[model samples]
Target: MSRLLLVVLLLANVGTAIGVVYARHLHRQSFIELARLEKTRDELNIEFGRLQLEQATVAESNRIDAIARTRLGMKFPEASDVVVIQP
Candidate 1:
């Protein structure tokens, strides 16, 4: 009976050790995955900033006015063409 009890205790200790190793492996894997995600997030943030700058440059009023004048041949109305109506 005493030997049987010793064998059970030894088996339990081995099982616990195996569990500890598996837990450590999972912790390492999670750490590596977190680092990879953080790097991807930083790269996306940089790309977002660049896109915002490009959008601002493209939406400038001066650039739009230049395009309108050159491409569409749009011009401001002359004073003689202005008609004032008193209502």
Candidate 2:
């Protein structure tokens, strides 16, 4: 009976040790995944910032006017072509 009790205690200790190792492994994996996700998030943020800057640049009035004049062949009306209406 005493030997049996010793065997049981030894088995329980080994089980506990295995549980600890498994938990540590899971923790390390989770930490690595967290780091990877954070890196991806940072890269996306940088891209978002660049896109915002590009959008601002594209939306500028001077750039729009330049594109319209160059690409669309648009021009302002001559003064002689103006017809002013008194309201």
Candidate 3:
């Protein structure tokens, strides 16, 4: 009976050690994945900032006016061309 109890205890200890090893492996894998995701998030944030800057540049009033004049042949009205009416 004593030998049987010892065998059972040894088996339980081995099983617990295997569980610990698996848990450690999972933790390491999770840490690596977290690092990868954080790197991707940082890269995307940089790209988003660049895109926001480009959008701001494109949306500036002077840039719009230049494009209108150069590409669309638009022009501001001269004083003689102005017509005012009471609304």
| Per-residue lDDT of candidate 1, residues 21-82 (tens digit) | 99999999999999999999999999999999999999999999999999999988999989
RMSD of candidate 2 to the true fold?
2.8
The weakest ten consecutive residues by lDDT in model 1 span 74-83
Q: Between candidates 1 and 3, name the one with more favorable TM-score.
A: 3
Give TM-scores for every candidate, taking all chains together and pairing residue i with residue i.
0.81, 0.83, 0.87
Pairs clashing within candidate 2: none
Return the lDDT, model 2, position 8.
Answer: 100
Q: Give candidate 3 misplaced runs (Cα > 4 Å).
A: 79-87
Tens digits of per-residue lDDT for model 3, 1-87: 999999999999999999999999999999999999999999999999999999999999999999999999999999999999999
Which residue pairs in candidate 1 have backbone atoms (N, alpha carbon, C) closer than 3 angstroms, thus clashing? Answer: none
Number of clashing pairs per prediction, in order: 0, 0, 0
Task: Count clashing residue pairs in model 3.
Answer: 0
Rank candidates, lDDT, best first.
3, 2, 1
The top-ranked prediction according to TM-score is 3
Model 2, range 3-85, lDDT digits (tens) per residue?
A: 99999999999999999999999999999999999999999999999999999999999999999999999989999999999
| Pairs of residues at least 3 apart in sequence or in different chains that clash in candidate 3 | none
